[model samples]
Every structure is written in C-alpha cells, then in structure tokens.
Target: MSAASAFDDDIRRARALEQANPAEAGRIYMSVLEQDPANIEASNALERLNDPHRYSSWMRINCVIDPRDDIFRFIGTGPYSHNPIREYLSDGWRTLSELMVVMDKLDQPLTRVSSFLEFASGFGRFTRHLVKVLPGRVACSDVMPGSMEFAREQFGVEAFYSSFEPEQIEFPRRYEVVFVLSLLTHLPIEVWGRWLKVLAGAVAPGGVLIFTVHNEEVLRDQLGVKFDETGYSFLPSSESPSLEASQYGTSLATAQVVAEQVRQALGTDPVLWEECAFWVGHDAIAIRPHG
Candidate 1:
C-alpha cells in the first residue's frame, strides 16, 4: 500500500484500540508519526494517549463504572458512548484546536502567551492540553478543591481553588489568555454579570478573554425552545437536569444579550463574536480585544 493509505489504515486501527488499549494505540500512532511526521491525526492521537495527566485507572473506572459525575455525562454522550476518558481527551483536543483558531483570528500568537488560566477547569479536561500547546505556566481553578488537586497532581499545573460566589474568587496573577468554558452556561443571570467582570479582571490588558455560553441555537436545538424577541432564556435546574443541565441547569443567551453583558462588564464591545465557534456546536465565543 502507498504511504497515505497505510497512514489512514493505522489511524483507523489506532482509534479502535484507543478505548480498549490506549497504550497500544499510542505506540501505533507513534509509529505512524515516524513514517509521516506531518500526520496531524496521528500526532493528536498519540498526544492524547501519552498525556501524563490522563486520568488514573481508578478515576477512569469511576467514570465508566458509575457514570454519576456530571462531567462524564456531558462529554461521554453519543460518539463517546460509555468511554468517558476518550470523551474527555477528545474534548481537550477539540477545545485546543478551537482556541488556536480563535487566537489566530485575534492575531494573537500562541507562542506570545506567557501565562494561561482555565477557569472552572473541571479536573483539567482542557488544562492538560493547554499545558502542552502553550509555552507558559498553565493554571487551573475550580470551585471543587478535589478537582483542583486532581489537576495539579495529574497535569503538574498551578492549581487554585475558586468560590461559588464570583466576587469572592481571585487569581494569584493576571493571564494573557483566560478561558471560561461551560461555566457561564450554568450561572444564573444575576450571577453572570459578576462572574464576567471577575473573569475579565483576570485578563491582562491587551490580552484575550475567551468564554462559552449556551446560546439561542442550543435552546432551539436541545430544548425545543424557539428564539423569541428576548435575548436570553433560563431553564432552572429542577426542569431539565440532564446534559447541559447537569449542574445548575441551563441558561441560553443570545448573541445580542451576550454582547450587552460583555459591554456592561468591560465597557466595550468584543473584538469578535462568533456563534458555535466551539466544536461547531451551540456554544458562542466572544473575545475581548487587546488594548
């Protein structure tokens, strides 16, 4: 077989081995890379399998055996099926790729970033990849102390504990890139403004603040809620308590409402606004411009 065809076959085989035997899959990916250094798929697969911060065996068992954790339920749906570890690592790759594109759009070089912070990191799902992509100190924070500990131990990151109340939370230092993923989707409207301000405050001037929100697109597709004149919709945790509603439930914000909130928080409009920039899904991305 030709080089390209052989590479494709190896990738398929690696993917099949990934869930059942990640270490073996990693070796296959490494061999593919040796043959074709520029194989992005093989490189990404190898990285995911070889990540030092990957969840421990017991942690993987918990996610697969119990499936009670909200994080597992969120990413392990459909394609991931019952394999939460694969889902988790896949999300990290997807998130990193998206953020790189966003940074390129902003004309910000990932190499220039000296410090990165991932807010509401949730056991370092994305943090693990962030540490690999950026040549900087990657810090992760979450309201759950256990999650922070896990991130620190697994990823060798600077970990900190956050508070449920946004106003009470503080970072040790400013960051060139601050990412808030899946946090705003859970906050109530009253808490949104405060959290936005606090997270934006953590960004250094001329830096970028990236965040995700469940927008009207998600509301329509997932909840069967049509887009109304109002720019926001709230679904209490008591209502639909699955998927995006795993935690405090879901709040769907429109582009207009999210823009207004960012304006209120930063006193200026975002540099860029894109709907579904995350994984081509319902999440919206807004970037604060560099001064």
Candidate 2:
C-alpha cells in the first residue's frame, strides 16, 4: 500500500486498540512515527499512552514502589496521609500548574526553557509532569542512588546522584530552570544558606529558580510557633540517624527569613515571595540576573 494508505490504516488500528490494549496501540503509534517522524497524530497518541497521569491505578502503585528504595514509600504514604497515589499525582499536577503561573508572571514561559534540573527528585514525582510540560532535557538528582535510578528508568529523564553537602554535588551543566520541590523544607538551618547558593548557581543567567519551603503558616499550625520571632524552626525527625530523618524532617521558615536566606545565599533579593504558593505549601522564587 502507499505511505498515506498505510499510515491511515495504522492510525485506525491504533485508536481501536488504545482502550483495550494500550501497550500494543502505543507500539503501533510509535512505528508510525518511525515511518513519518513528523506525524503529530501518532506522536500525540503515543504521548497520551505514556503519560503517568493516564496510567491505571495498578500502574501507579507499581511505579511508586521499588523494593530497594524506601524513599518512595515514605513520600507516598507520609506526606500524602490518605490515598498516597492519588494525593501524590494531585500534588504533581498542582505544582506544575502553579509553576506555570510563576513562569507567566516572570515573563519566562515554559516554551522558552531548553533545559531543566530537578534537585532532590524523589522517584520522578514531579519530574514526570515537568518533562511533559517543559519540552526540554530534564535531569533529576537525588542523594539516593535508587531514587535517581527509578526517576531515569521510569520517567525517561537523565538522572544523577547528589551529595548531602551542597558544595559536593555537581551538574553536567547549568539549566534554564532549576526546580527544588519540598527539598528546602527539610534542610537544617546550617545548610540552608549554602544549599540555596549552590542551587541558585545552577540556573543560567536570566533563568529562574523555583523552590518550595514550609512557611510561617505551617509552623503556626503544626508547631504553634511564630516564625516572625524565631525566623525558623526545625523538628528533629524521630527517625534520627537514618537518611530519611536527615532529609525529610519537619522544618519551617517565615517568608522574610526565606527571602533573607535567598539574598544571603544568592546575593540577590528573591523576585517573588508568595506565602504557601506551592500547593498552598511553600514560599520564594528567585531569578538569576542576566549579564
């Protein structure tokens, strides 16, 4: 058959099998792409099938769990509280949506970004969605090797292992956007300034650094403390001495304190400071000045 006729036939078959046998349908759609690299319909179909959000509950459960890695279990079940899978997915969506807003306000549209770095990425939670939205080379890093492996294998992103020490970790190159989600919230006060500087330095000049941190509001509700007076608070993890406790312990900072930390670390005032902007749960946005 002619190329046009063959493409049409493949498209019809792929659509027919999508709901019942998406894997096979995906293969067929991918083959169409191989024949015609610019086939938008086939490309869209393939992307839809591969989207984590569209995955079945069984698939999500499997994706979130790795027998060798306990970080997945901790993040999924710990912060999520109830219905881990659903909440995790929802948080990813909410984070992406809010990031879009931040980008728009900053005049840095997602389309303009050519590379992204997700620091402290845990099992591709947000990295998966970021890849879909950014259309860039997405690289994820975590102190845990298993988490990095899981993100690279499951989310189709480049991955690297990081060190707990801010100065020890390195990247292949700077990125147009560096995302730090739920990471700063757990760092101890001692490393806060240094980590912020290191992460901010990863952004290309004129690029943006977006991060989430527990604000004063959280401290008030959870610990009955006022950040304005104390600046920051840290609740030592009960699981101390374990990596989880050191990396996932409860910490909070006031907006002023966060901005001050950014200024001290990055040598510039934060561009935006929204109390609980991330899923209504973090503060601060900084942009690297362009030369």
lDDT of 2 at 80: 39
> TM-score of each candidate?
0.70, 0.71
What are the per-residue Cα lDDT tens digits for candidate 2 across 1-291?
114355999999999999999988988877776775434456557556773333333333223333334443454446434544345455666777877777777777866788889887766667767877664488989876578878766677888888987888878888888988777778787788888878877888777788877767766786577655668777767322346675558677777777777777777776766666776557646556442
Q: How well does candidate 1 match the true structure in TM-score terms?
A: 0.70
Tell me the lDDT of model 2 at 42.
Answer: 68
Worst 10 residues of 1 by lDDT: 58-67
* Per-model CA lDDT versus the true structure: 0.68, 0.69
Using TM-score as the measure, the top candidate is: 2
How much is 105 displaced in model 2, in angstroms? 1.4
Candidate 2 has its poorest 10 consecutive residues by lDDT at 53-62
Which lDDT value does model 2 have at 278? 76
Question: Per-residue lDDT for 95-155 in model 1, tens only?
Answer: 7778777777878876568888888887666776777666347888987537776776667
Q: How accurate is candidate 2 locally (lDDT)?
A: 0.69
